[model samples]
Target: MMKKNYITAFDGLRAVGVLAVIAYHLYPQTVQGGYLGVVLFFVLSGYLITDLLSREYRKNQTIDLKGFYLRRFKRLMPLLVTVFLVTSLYLTAFQPNMLNQMRMSFVSALLSFYNWWQIAKGGSYFANLMAEAPFKHVYSLAIEAQFYMIWPVILLLAFKLIKRRSLLIFSLLLISILSGLEMALLYQPGQDPTRVYYGTDTRLFSLLIGASAALAFPSQDQRLAKLVRARQKGLNRLFLLAMLLMLASLIYLSGQSDVIYRGGMFSFSLLSALLIVLSTQANLYLTRFLSNPLFRYLGERSYGLYLWQMPVFTLFELKFPGATGSWLVLLELILLLGLTEIFYRLVEKPARSVKWQSFKEKGRVFFATPATIGKAVGISSFYTLAFIGIFAMIGIFQAPDLSYAQETIAAQLSQNQTKEKLGQASMSQETIETLSQQYEVSSQVFVQEEPIAIVGDSMIAMTYDHLRQAFPTAYIDGIIGRSGEHGVPMLEETLAQIPDAKKVVISLGINTDGPVILNRNTIDQMMSVLADKEVYWMTINLSQSQYTWTDQVNAELQAASQTYDNFHLIDWYQATIGQESAYLAEDMTHPNQAGQVLYTKMILEALAQ
Candidate 1:
C-alpha cells in the first residue's frame, strides 16, 4: 500500500477559508473582504490537484489518465448532484417563485460552466447574491471544475515540453500574473465587476499560483520537510504573518474596489501560496495549529459547509426578508450542519470510497434478506420523492418574462423612446417624471410648494412616480445604482438647475461604495451646496442591512439631524421601523407599489420645520 501524502494544515486552512466566505455572505458588514476566501480555495485546489498528479507522474513516470478522471468524478459529482437534488426538493415543495432561477441554475451547474453562464447572462455577482440566487455559490465550483477538466492535459503537455521543473513553475507564475493583468484591464470602476469576477481566464491567477507552489513544494520531499523542521522558528513566524495578512484581507477587503481587481487578490494569492508551501512541512508549528480536532473536522467537511451556505442563507432571508440576528445565525448554523451531514453520510463518503463490486454482492444479499426489505423500502421512498422534485424542477420555467429590476429598466427604456432628453443635466423625461400638473396632498403638508428637489439612488427610482405625484413641480432625478458620492454630483446638478430650491430630499446610501450619506464630510459638502436650506435626508430602509453600509449611513443621518439645525433628517427608517412587511417589496429594499404611496406620505409628514 502507498503511504498517503496528506498535509494536515490544509484542512485547517480550508476551515478558515469557508468561515470567511460564510461570514461574508451572512454578515458582510463584519467581514467585507470575506470573498477573498474563494481565491484562497482556488489556490489550494490548484496546488492539491497539481501536487497529486505530479507525484503520480514522478513515481510511475506517467499519469494514469483513466484513474485520474474516474477518481475526480467520484470525488466531485456525487455531492454536487446531491445538493441540486435536495435543494430542488425544497424549492419544488415550497418556493415556486424561485423555480425559474433554480431551473437555470440546475442546467448551468450540470454543464460545468456555471461561472461562464453567469458572465454570459450578464448577472451581477453582488446583485445576484442580493437577489438570493441559491446557486450563486456554484460560480467558484464551476471554475474549479473547469480547471479540473482542462488543466491535467495542459500540465501533461507542459511536463513533456519543459525539461526542468523550475521552468514549468516559473511559467505557471507568469501565466498567473498575466491573468491578473487581464482582470485589471477588464475591470471598470463604478460598474458591476461580475464579468471579470466570473471569467475563468480572469480568475486564473490564484489557481496558477497554487500550481506553481505545488511544483516547488511537495509534501513527500523529505529533504525540504527536514530543512523546514530545522528552521522551524523562523518559518513559523513567517507563516503566522501570512495567516494574519489573510485574516486582515478577509476583514477589510471590499469586493468591488479597484484594489481587489488590480492586484489585491493577486497579492493575497501569493501570501496564500506562501502559507501552503510552508504547510508542506510535516511537523511544522503551522501543521500543529491547523491539525487540531475542530479545525480538522471543519476542514474535512468544508465543501459541504460551503455548498449549504448560500442556499440556506437565501432560504432563511426569503422566509424572513431583512430578518437578521444572532438567533438567525445560530439557526443557519444548525440547518447547515444537519444538511451537510445528510449529504456527507449518504453521498460524499460512499461515492468517494465505496466500490461497485462490493456493493453489487451486498445489494444481492440485502434484497434476499427479509429484514432488509423495510430499509430498502425506506430508501426507495426517499429517492422517489427526490426524483419527483427533479421532475418538478424540470417543469419550472427558465426565468420570469422580466424580473422586477429588468421590468423597471425596460419601462425606463420604453418611456425614453417617446420623450426628448432633458437639457444640460441630460436626464431623460423617464428619469425626471416631472408632474407639471399641480396636485394637492392636503393643506397641512409643509414644504410641498417649497421648490423641492429630490436626488437619490434606486430607492428614489422605485418611488419616482409617487414622489412626482406627492410633490408636484419638484425636480426629481433618481437613477439606479447611484451611491452617496454619485448622489453628490446629482445633488450639485439639481442645485445648478433648481437654484432657489427650498428643501432638498436626498435618498441614498443603500448601495454606498464611497463615503456614506450624511457623514461629516458629506454634510460639509451638502452644507457648502446649500448653507441653511432645510435638508431632508432620508434614512436607509434596507432589509438586509448587513450587506450594505446602511448602519453607518443611518447612524450618520441620525447624528447629523441632532447636530445641524437646518438638516431636517427625514426618519424613513423610523417610519418603516417595524413595518418592513407592509412597506418593503420582496427585495426588502424598495417599497412595493402600494408602499410607494405610503413612502411619499412619510416623507411629507417627516418634513421638519
Candidate 2:
C-alpha cells in the first residue's frame, strides 16, 4: 500500500471520540449521550479502513489478506494485551471476586467477540451491571474488528463482481438500511436491549454508512473529484454544518432517550459520514480546527486513551470512593494521557515497526538483553508475590469467617422476620389492652387526628412507633413484606381520608423486586396521585444480600426528587451506606432500633427542609 500523509484532523476526531467515552464513563449524568462516540469511532474505522483497502487494491490489483490481518494486529493488539495483563494482575491482587469474571471477559476480548459474549451472559450494555464487566467497552472494538475481518472480503468480492461504483454504493446503502431496520425492529421499550445494543447486526449501519461514502467518493474518480472541487466552497460550509450537528447530537442525545436506538443512531451515522466527506477536503475552518496540534496529539494517543480509561477509572473509583471534583477529574485525564504515552512509546511503536519476514530477528534484538530478561522475571515475580499476598489477606480477613458471617446474616434475617410477626401480634394485643384498660365513649365520632401520614413496608413498620413519636400527629400505615407499588395506592387513600393533612412521609422501596426503571414507575405513579401534597420519600438501604437493587432503588428515588417539585428524598440511603450493617436487624433488609432512629432523623431533616 502507498504510504498516505497523516491528517491531523482525523486525530482531532479521534480525541473527540475518546474524550466523550471517558466523560461518559466517569460522569455519566453529565454526558449521558457520549456513548455515541463509539458510533463515531465505528464510522471512522469503516471510512479509514475502506480507504486503505481501496488504495491497496488500486496499487496491487488485489488485497493481501495475511498482510492486512498482520497490520490490524500490530495496530490493535499490543496495547490490548498490555492492558489485559496489567488489569488481570491488578484484579487478582486487589479484587479476587472479579477474577473469574475477568478471566471470561479477558478471553472474550482477546478473541474479539466480547459484545456477543456479554449478550450470551445476559448483560445489558447500558445497565448498571456493566460496571462489573471490566472489558465492556471492548465490545465496540470487537464490532470494529468483526467489520475489519469481513468487510475486505465483501468489498473485494463486490469490486470483482460488480466492478461499478454505482453498484457498490447501492449495495452498501442497502446493507446499512437493513442493519438500521434490524436494530429498530429488535429494540423493545421497558426491557433490556443488550442484544440490540451489542449485536453486530444492529450496529453494522454506522460502518456501512462510512463504507458507502468511501465507495461514492473514490479517490481516483475524476468526474466526482471535478464536481467536488467545483462545489468546494459550498461543501466546506456543509461540512462545517455537519460538524456542528454532530456536536449538537453528542450534547443533546442521551442513552435513556428512546430515539437513540430506534433512529437517532442511524442519524448519527449519516452525520459522521458527512464529517468524513468534509475531512477529505482542505481550506475548511472545521478542518483547520480539527487539524490543530492538541487535537492531533490527543487523536494520535486516542486508542491508548480509550483502552486505559475504563480500568483506570474502575480501579481509581474503587480505591478512592466518593473522590470527585474538577481537580480529581483533571488528575485522571493526566494519568490516562501519561499511561497512553508510555504504551504508545514502549508497545505500540515497536509493534508497528515489526516486519513479518524479519519478526524473529526483531524479537531477538528486542529480547536478547540481560536487562530485558531480568525486568520480565522481576515483574513476573512481583505479580506472583502480590497475588499471594492478596490471597493471604483474604483468607486471614474474610475466608475463615465467611461461613460464620453468612450464618449470622441469615440468623439476623430470621430474627427480624420473627420480630415483625410478633410486632403485628402486639398491635392487636395493645388494642385489646387499651379497650380493657380504658372505657371507650360510644358517641365519640371516630376521627383520626394525625396530620402527617407515614406509609411503608416492614422496614417502616419496624420504625412505626419511632416515627409516631417524632411526629405525634402522624398516622402510620406500615405492612410486613409490602413494596412501593402497594404503598402508593394506600398513600393516595390516606391522603383522601386525611384531607386536612398535607404532609406525607413515604418509606417504601426496601422490598422492590425489579430494577430502577420499575422503582421509577412506582415513584411516577405515586407522584401522579399525590402531586398536590408535600411528599417526603425515604430512600432505602438493603443488606449486602440485596445491595444491587438497593442502590438502584435509591438512585431512582433520588432522580425522582429532581423531577418532581412535591417529591423530596429523605436520603436514608446516604445515611445508612456505611452504617447499615450495624443498624440491620436479624432480617438483613430491616433496620434495627438504631437504624430506625437514624431513619426517623432523616425524615425529620427532610421535613425541616
Model 1 spans > 4 angstroms off? 1-3, 128-132, 356-388, 391-609
Q: Considering only N, C-alpha and C atoms within 3 Å, which residue pairs clash in candidate 1?
A: none
TM-score of each: 0.74, 0.67
The sequence of per-residue lDDT tens digits that candidate 2 reaches over residues 300-337 is 88899999987787666556544566787788888888
Q: What is the C-alpha RMSD of each candidate to the true structure, in Å?
A: 7.3, 10.4
Summed backbone clashes in each candidate are: 0, 4
What are the lDDT figures for the candidates, one per model? 0.72, 0.68
Query: Cα lDDT for residue 344, model 1?
Result: 69
Which pairs of residues collide in model 2?
412-586, 412-587, 413-586, 413-587
